[model samples]
Target: MLSWKPFALSVAVLLILFPFVYLVLLSLSSEWRFPDLLPSYFGLKNWATILGSEAGLLESFVSSLLISLSVAIVSTTSGFLISRAVFYHPKKNTLTLLAYFPYILAPVVFAACLSFFFLKMGLFGNITGVIVAQFIIAFPYALLFFSSFWNKKIKSYEDLVATLGGNRWQTFIKVLFPLAKGLILICFFQTFLISWFEYGLTSIIGIGKVQTLTIKVFLFIKEANYYYGALSCCLLIFPPVVLLYLNKRYVFKKLV
Candidate 1:
């Protein structure tokens, strides 16, 4: 028998890493003429320039992080409540199915459909508006993701807590949270990535006022600044990578 696991893993690694390698190479190259496999020269000057600037990469990176974090926390927390509500309802199946409608739709189309309301509310072009728009995309998926945890076994645990005189707060704090903790963390990170990489809704709702890292990457590309675009990509990859490492080392281990 032939073992293909190692070969598959190697291929997967290459597929994932090749783009990052190309981006790094492009970012570092001062000049590379045609037909060259590698750049003529490489330097950290681009990164230094991006970091030292007052109102460019650094500001955009911070703005992106703030908005993404806010969207993640708000979407996950609210979606949890919404999922619970639907879970206990008589029409749970129907409602749960309906919850996925937004998630399935293209984000640009969804945002465009709601553009008028945003304009009327004076939310268009505002950071709050961008957050709200992203939440619209993120919350539905979180709700659906969380709905899986509200199964019969979990319900029995809830019932047990209630039978023991645990009120709503006590029930959630002691029983519900403990069982749902891992799933909640997963939902948070999923929605975090959703908001972190979201550009369509943000561009539509924020009207280009809110310049996130995704937007910065596009803008840099538009200006033919591959180095800055790669820099933004690197910055965008940082938080999620760090979170994934921390989650693996701590949160997932704790869950196990």
Candidate 2:
């Protein structure tokens, strides 16, 4: 009997690599049209143009990096704390359901519903508003991600910490942090990618003022600049890919 694992792994690798190959081709090709198996000409012009000063993409990249890192830190930390509370609460299922509502809903619809409130609060069309909007979606996911940490084993450790005269802060700092550093990293990266790739909420809340990389990609696509769109897509995928590699290689290894 033939095992299916190798066949499945082969298909998975092809699925993952195919789009990336196409994206790289699109980014580098200067004259590859339909029916061409490969481009006759390839250069770094697309990369140079996007990164050059006139494109303002460098600023967009920096903006996205800052916003993603901020969202990751803020959402992950807050979600961890909130998840702890939700885990301990009597109505844990209800609280968890509430947390899932934001994340499970269509982000565009969620943002649209909140846009008026944001305007009323004078938060629309700014970086801060965009961060808050993203946090609403990312925080719920972070909460769910960290919920897995709140099991019987964790409760035992907490009880031990309490018996050792450790307060909540000490238990979290000394015990939970060390035990769950990998999970924290995973949550941070997940939230970071959520904010980094977020388009709808940022679009609605930012109102074109805050130009994230995802927004940049959309604008380029809207303008029919496929090359620049491909470039932006490449930039967008790079960090997450690297982080995933590191997470698999180092972070998860640390967990074990």
Candidate 3:
């Protein structure tokens, strides 16, 4: 008797992978117009543009990496430390609630609200401005995420560290940091993703001057350039995929 289980599993796998497969195919091809069963051309030609100055994709990719890395590192470290302070604060709940304020507004609205300050500070339409804007959004998320990492048990660890003649910095370096290492890495990964794919805040704050890979992808799409858009997408997905693999291999294993 023929069983349908294998067939169903294969179909499910193909369904899940179809979009990514199609995207790669699209990125490698051009002139795929209507009524044509396939693209008129296909090869490394589109991918090759990344090395040339014509695409500016290589620059965009580097800019995105730098911004995302900065935002992730700052947000994760600050959030972890600040969340500890909040845990010990009298109005911990209130402070924690305030962290959610960023999420209350839509990204575009939030950008608009922040524009006046950015303009005043001379942060308008530049890389620094974009980084600051993305940091604002990513920071609160990290803060909230680390909130759960602080509890009575963690407090006990701090108390124990103090009892052992450990200073505040010593406690963090020798104990707290090691204990929270997994969470920190995970937070970094999450925050990195947040900044990596951010569009609305980047668009408004950057004013199209700071063109990150996400911005490049949008520009390509807006101009009705699907081939380049797909290529940009392929570039955009690369870092997160590498991060995910590292997390799975190193972070998640340690976690488990």
Candidate 4:
């Protein structure tokens, strides 16, 4: 007989995974509607149709990927380095606020502030604006995660490097970054997810014209195309899932 502890944990995991599995099933189903209990048939038509529709869904996917990747790299790197500086200084005004605010405030309010300035500058409602907005949103996540890692695992090493013959820049490149590799990976995955699923800010800043996959799903849903909407959702959700998996395996290898 299975113990309740182990069995309950397994059930919980299955429950968590059920939605993703069902989404895949829906994406594979040829046609679906209410009261069927299950689909009449399954095929690749929905996936193929969405990919080949000339509706720019795929373009949106590419755009989201590019922006998210860019944000992940720049935000994580910049945040990680800034984390080192803040940890060393511990009293800088700007860094102090930046370290804490990203988590405390609502994202919509944050987006609003960014969009205001960006729009006045003629940078809003466009790719550049979206990229800039995403960077700001993702920056705090990287900074905080790195701050924790800095305090716990990497500080002594940084100090040792500084004492031995390494300047801060050299130690950051040679020691801090290396020691904080797992934290950096964690931040990258987090930033990527934030950028990819980010609908409101991207949509608000991009308007309707710059429709990423998440925004595309929302548009399709609002237009009442359930099948295509579901397909787009799967598309929007999976890339980050795959990337997160890769980051766990490859980037966070040291942690394991």
Candidate 5:
């Protein structure tokens, strides 16, 4: 008898991967028109354009990397440190609940609300503005994420450190940091992703001037340039894929 289980599993795998497979195929082809089973031209020419100034993809990729890295580093570090304070505060729950405020509004609306201040502060249409905007969103998420990391056990660890004559700085360096190393890395990865794929906030705050990769992808799609869109999409997923692999291979392993 034929095993339908194997067939079903294969079909599921193909369905899940079809979009990514088609995206890669699309990136490699050009002038693919209706009723054509394949593109008119298929080669590395599309990929090669990334290196040229015409596509502007390489620039967008670099800009996105810098902005995401900046947001992730600052948000994750600040979130981790401040989350500890929130955990110990008398109004801990209220403060933590306020962390959800940024998420309550949609990104576009939030960006719109902050637009006037960003313009006045000269943050509009700049990389720093985008980073700051994204940080506003990512920081609260990081705060909420680490909030659960500060339970009674962790407080006990702090108390233990203090009983041993260790100061706050030493306790953080020697104890808390090492204990939360995996969580911090995971938070960094999460916050990086939050900033990486952000479009609405970036679009509004950047004022169409700061072209991050996500912005570039939307622009290409808006322009009906699917070839470039697919190409940009390829660049878009690369970093997160690498980060996922690293997290799985090293971070998750240690975490387990």
Candidate 6:
């Protein structure tokens, strides 16, 4: 018999998707408020305006993209190298844990503490400041993903590589890394998504001048600009959706 569990699971999925459907419909709808069960009309006009306006809206989009990409590359690369160090040398864990544990703190609280230091250093409200701030949030995620393989798999592999005349870097490049490459990509994407959608830390550190989509969406909602608010929310969701789709398309195959 076909299980009831599958049917129950499918309904649950639909319920979760209903809000996204409502948002998409809201973006398309001519007008919708609490009284309405459904939108009065539907059209592409809102999307067209938001995407084609070129009125600093797109600049914000570009800003978010670049910042997320920067966070991803730097955090992932650093985490990968750091994980390699942690893997090959047991002595480094003491100092590494001391440094890395701070990343596990909530971003808002962490950024608040660091913001004071940045203010003293004259670094607040700057793009460089935001990028560097996001690195702290991104690094731990990358470390968690990359470090997993090392805990159980690397020692034997390293010994094997060494016996075969492969040094640490060579073994990393030729052996350990090739195996870990998929995990690294997943880590990069995960970190980029966090940096992309992150609001609390970005807002605290950027101080409203360095606007990301999440910040902008909050601002729009506060002003009661429901159309632009919904529009902004959808746009805020776009990058991660694209990132996930691209990963599923191009990267999932390699991992599987």
* Every model: Cα RMSD to truth: 2.2, 2.4, 1.4, 2.8, 1.1, 2.8
Write one digit per residue (lDDT tens) for candidate 1, span 147-195.
Answer: 7788889888888888888899988888888778888898888899999
Model 2: weakest 10-residue lDDT segment is 49-58
Best by TM-score: 5
| Per-model CA lDDT versus the true structure | 0.86, 0.90, 0.92, 0.79, 0.94, 0.81
Give me the displacement of residue 21 in model 1, in angstroms.
Answer: 2.4
Please, what is the TM-score per model? 0.91, 0.90, 0.96, 0.86, 0.97, 0.85
lDDT of 5 by residue, 1-256 (tens): 9889999999999998888889999999999999999999999999998899998899999999999999999999999999999988989989988889996678889999999999999999999999999999998999999988999999999999999999999999999999999999999999999999999999999988999998999999999999999989988887898999999999999999
- Per-candidate clashes come to 0, 0, 0, 0, 0, 0
Candidate 3 residue spans exceeding 4 A from truth: 1-6
Model 4 poorest 10 in a row by lDDT = 146-155
Model 1 TM-score is 0.91
lDDT of 3 by residue, 161-240 (tens): 89989999999899899999999999999999999999889999999999999899999999999999999999888788
Candidates by TM-score, descending order: 5, 3, 1, 2, 4, 6
Q: Which candidate, 3 or 5, has the higher TM-score?
A: 5
Candidate 4 Cα errors over 4 Å, as ranges: 1-10, 90-98, 152-156, 159-163, 250-253
Shift of residue 123 alpha carbon in model 1, Å: 0.8
| Best by the lDDT measure | 5
Candidate 4 C-alpha lDDT tens digits along 1-256: 7579988999999999998898888878855677898898788877777667565777888988888889989998898877777866747557767667866776667777777798898877788888888888788777777656656446677678878988978986787667667777778888888888888887778877778888888898898877678778888878777887788678767676
- State the lDDT at 114 in candidate 1: 100
Estimate candidate 3's alpha-carbon lDDT, on a 0 to 1 scale: 0.92
Clashing pairs in 4: none
